[model samples]
Target chain A: MPDPVGAVARLQQELTRLPGVGPKSAERIAHFLLSGDRKTAVALADALRDVVARVRPCRECFNLTEGELCPICSDSRRDAGSICVVETPRDIALFERAGSFRGLYHVLGGRLAPLDGVGPDQLTLAALAQRVRRGGVREVILATSPTLEGDGTALYASNLLDGTGVTITKLARGLPSGSSLELANPQMLVDAMDGRRTL
Target chain B: MPDPVGAVARLQQELTRLPGVGPKSAERIAHFLLSGDRKTAVALADALRDVVARVRPCRECFNLTEGELCPICSDSRRDAGSICVVETPRDIALFERAGSFRGLYHVLGGRLAPLDGVGPDQLTLAALAQRVRRGGVREVILATSPTLEGDGTALYASNLLDGTGVTITKLARGLPSGSSLELANPQMLVDAMDGRRTL
Candidate 1:
C-alpha cells in the first residue's frame, strides 16, 4: 500500500491489529482519521490511552471496573446469597442485558482447556470454592455458555461445589422462544429434546 | 453492560469508531490488547502517534510520504511526462503493485458526487490540468473505478483536458482472470464490451 501520513498510517496499523480488519479496512480507517475532524482523532487517541491506564478487574467478581469492586459486586440490591458463575465478564453483561437475573456473579477468567494447559488451578475455581464454603449461599447457578468448553467448566464447577449444601442449577434449554424447527441447529435440537418438560 | 477495565473499555470504544468495527469485535480486540504483552500496546500507540506527527501528502502527486514528494515522484526512472490519475492513494498502491506502469500519479482524492456535494473544485482536477498543460506530458490515464460517479469524474476530466493534446486512456476490462461471468455486474459487462480488442 502507498504509505499514508505517518500518524494516519500508525493509527491504521493499530486499528488493523483488531480482529476482522484487513489492509483495505485499515486504509479506510486511516483516511477517515486524517480527513475527519481533529476532535474525533483526539477523542479516539485519548480513549485508547485512558482504557489502558484506568480500567482494572474487580477484586471480588473479576468484572471490569475502575475501582477495587465492580458495580455489580457493590450493589446492595442484588442477591448476594446466590452467585451465578460465568467464564468472562462479557457473559455477565449478556445476563445483565437480559434483565431477568438479580444475583451476584463470579467470573472464572476462562474455561478449562487441557490442550491449552488451562485447568481448575489456573482459573478462579479455588476462590469460588472458598466463597461457597464461607456459607449462607443458597444456590450456585452454572450459567456458562453451551459450548463444549463451557459445558466442561460448568460440570467441573458443579463437582467442586458438591456436598457444599448449595443447590446447583443450569439455565433452561428448549426451542428458543420464537424459533421454529427449520431454524434450529443440530445442537439446539438435541438440547430441546434433552430438556423437554412433562405435562 | 458491566464496565470492563476502564482502560480496556476506553480502548474498545476508540477501536469501534473505525469503519466496520462493532462492539463485539471491539471487545475482542480490547481483550487481545489486555492479554498481550505491554510492548505490543506501546508499539501500536507509538506508531499511531508517530504516523500522525510525521506523514503528509506529497505536494506534487498527493501520494502519502514523509517528505513533500513521494518516492514515485522523486524516482529518476519514473516517466515524469505521463501522469496516471486515480481517485485515491490506495489506487496508486494497487497500480504500483501491478508494476507494469512506469508513470507518476495524481490522486483526485475522491470522485464527484453531487448528492454528497462533492464537485470538481473539491478535487485535484485543476492541479492535474496544470500538470498536463506544462508541456512535456504525452499521456494521461483515467484509472477511476467503474462506478457512475467514477465515470462522471472521468468524462468531466476528459472535457477539461480536451484542448491539451494529451492522449487519455482508461484501464482495460474483460472477465477478470479468476472471476466467473455469473458474478460480473452490469457496469463490468459494459466496460468489457467497450474495452474489447481484436483477437
Candidate 2:
C-alpha cells in the first residue's frame, strides 16, 4: 500500500518509462533489484549514466556511436557504395544479426508518421541526402518494415532520390520464409504472387 | 557489430542481469534508451541510486522500507497480534493488492531450499521466532506458496512456534477460483479433493 518505500516507488516509476515496461513489470524489476545485493543496481545505474554520457549519433550514418563515426562507417571492409536504410538503429542490429548485409547503414531515426506530426524534417533524411550527394553511393536499399507507414516512407525517400542518378530499391514483400501459404494473410499472398520469380 | 559504442554494450550487458531480460531484450532496451532524450536514462539512474542508498529491510518484519519500521508495521489500525508470514516483501505487496489481509507481515526472505545451499540460518526465521516470543501475537499464518519448498518452510516455521502457545495455521490449498476442472492438474485435483470443506 502506497509503496513501502518512497525510493522504491520512484525507481518503479522511472522504470515504467522504458519501452515495453508496464507498471506491473516496473514494480517487479524494482523489487528484484532490491531483493538482490546492491551490486546489480549500482552497476545498472552506472551503465545507464555511461551510455547517456558517451553514446552519440555517428557523423556519417546517424547510427549510435561513442566517436565521430559508427563502427560500420569507420570500417574499410564494408561496402561504402551500398547503403541499407532503416527506420531506427535497432533495425541495424537486426540486419547485423542476420549477417547477410555487408554494406553500411543509414538510420532514418523514424519513418514518416504525418498523423502523429512526424515529417521528413524530423528525421535524419537531409543528412542521408547529403551523404548520398557527397559521393559514390551506387545503391540505396529501403529496408523499412512492410507496414503502410514504412511503404509511405520508402516511397517518399525514393522520390527524394529520383534525380540523383543512384539506383534506389526497397526490400521485397512476400510470405515470410518459414511461414505456410495457408497461414499467409491476403496482402502477403498478393505480394508473394506479384513478386514471384523464375527458379 | 561489437556494439557501436562500448558504453551502450556495457549498458546492455548490465540490463540482461535484470529479471526476465535476455540478451535480445537487453539490446532493445539499451538502444531504446540511446534513441530517446537523455532525460529518461538520467532519471532512471538517479532513481536506482536513490533506492539503493535509502531503502532498507524493515526492522520488525524484514519487509522493504526506508525507515526503521515498514508502513504496515507502523500503521496503528493493523492487527499486530496476527502476523501473515510470507517468503518475500514482494508477497506483501501482493497481499496488500488483494486488500483482504489486515494483519502485519513477517518476511521469511526465502523458502527452504537446502539443495541450493539455503539453510534455516540464511533466512530470518530466528528473527521471526524472537518476534513471536517477545509478544502478545495470537496467530501466525503461514502464507508461503503451496509448493514442496514452501510446505517445508511452513512446517519448519510451525514447529519453531510449537511451544509459544500461539495458533499456527497455513493457507488452504484447492482449485483456484474460476478455474475449470478439465484444466486442473492432477496435483491440484488431489489438493482440491483432500481439502474439501463442509458447506
Candidate 3:
C-alpha cells in the first residue's frame, strides 16, 4: 500500500538532498526519526531553522558566525598581525581542533576552479587583499589543501597580495604521520625528499 | 576559536543521535544546512514535525498510518481472509513494493529476542491472536526474516494461533536469487536441499 501519510516521504526526500546522504540512508534516517522520540526529530528541525536564520559569514574574514564578527576576529588575545587563508570555514575548525595557529583566519568561500566556472570573483580574495593592504599584518599563510585546484588558488592569492609586503607562505607537504613509506605515493615521496629538514 | 553560533553545534549534536550518523558526518550535515538555502532546512523541519504529529499505528494491524486503519486493512480489494504476518511496518512496504500477496498484514512491532529482553508481551502477539480468533481469517503467513530470532518469533506466533481452525504457513527459506552457490552457507545449502521441489 502507498504511504498514507506523505510526511514520511517528504522527510526522506529532503534528507537525500544533504551532502553524502542517498536514498537508502535517507530511508533509514526517516524511519529512525519516526520510530524514536518525537522530541529528537523536532529538536533537529528547530536547530536547522535556527541556524539558517542566524548564521552568516564573518564581515572581516568571511568565516561562518552568528555575530557581526567571528570569534577569532573578535578575540583580543589572537595575533591580528598574522592571517591564515583557507578555502572554507570548515577548514578553520580543523586548525582549531589541533590547537596550533594563534593567528586570525580568512575564509575564501571557495577555491579557484576554472572548469567549474569558479573564479577569483567567487571567492573573498578581494577582501583578503584589502585586509593585507590596510597594513599592520606581517604574514599571510595559504593553508589550502595540496590538490591541483588548491595549489592554483594559493598561487592566485599570492600574486594578488604581491605588493602588500606581507610575508606569503603555503602549507608544507610530505608523507602524513603514521603512514608507512611503502604506502607513500610517488608525489608524496618527492615532496618528503624535497621538504626534508634538520631534525 | 569556539563556534559563536550555538545552533550549529546543537544541530551536529542532535544529528549524531541518528542510526548511522557520527560526529564527522553530523558536522558535514550541519555545515551543509547552514550554508545552503534557508528553505531546504525549513522544509525538512516541517516534514519531520508533520510526520511526528500525524503518523500512528493502524488500530487493526499495527502498521504505521495516518488513519485508524492502514491502507491494506481498509481496502476491500485486499484478501482479508489471508493475513501476512511480519515483524515491522517496514516489512509491509517491502511486500507492497514486490506487488505480490493481495492480502492484509499484521505487524508484530518486533521479534522475540530473549537476550535483548524482548518477549511476546513486548510484541503485538496478543492483538494478533485476537484477530485470528475473531474468525473469517483462513490463513496466517508468517513472513519474518530467516534469522534465529525471526524464526523463533514465527514459531511462538504459530503456537499462539493454534486451535483457531486457521491454516498456518511461513515464508520459504533458501538462498536468495542472483547469489552464487559457492557463497551459500552450509545451513542455507541444507535448507535449499531439504525444501527442493520438482519443476
Looking at model 1, residue A106 earns an lDDT score of: 93
Tens digit of per-residue lDDT, candidate 1, span A59-110 = 8877777788888988999999999999877788778878888989998988
* Native contacts kept (model 2): 0.79
The residue-level lDDT of candidate 3 at B123 comes to: 93
Q: Model 3 chain A, poorest ten-residue lDDT window?
A: A1-10
Winner on TM-score between 1 and 2 is 2
Q: What's the CA error at residue B60 for candidate 3, in Å?
A: 2.7
- For model 3, what is the error of residue B115's alpha carbon versus the real structure, in angstroms, after optimal superposition? 5.3
Instruction: Give the alpha carbon lDDT tens digit for every residue of B42-145 in model 3.
Output: 88888888888888889999888888987788889999999999988778877888898898999998899999999899999999999989988999999988
Q: Which stretches in model 2 have alpha-carbon errors above 4 Å? A: B2-4
**CAPRI-style quality class for the chain A–B interface of candidate 1:** acceptable
DockQ order, best first, reads: 2, 3, 1
Which is the better candidate, 1 or 3, if ranked by lDDT?
3
Model 3: CA > 4 A from native: A1-4, A114-117, A181-190, A193-199, B1-5, B114-117, B193-199
Scored by CA lDDT, what does every candidate get? 0.80, 0.91, 0.87
Candidate 2 residue B59 C-alpha distance from true site, Å: 0.7
Interface RMSD of each: 3.0, 1.3, 1.8
lDDT winner: 2
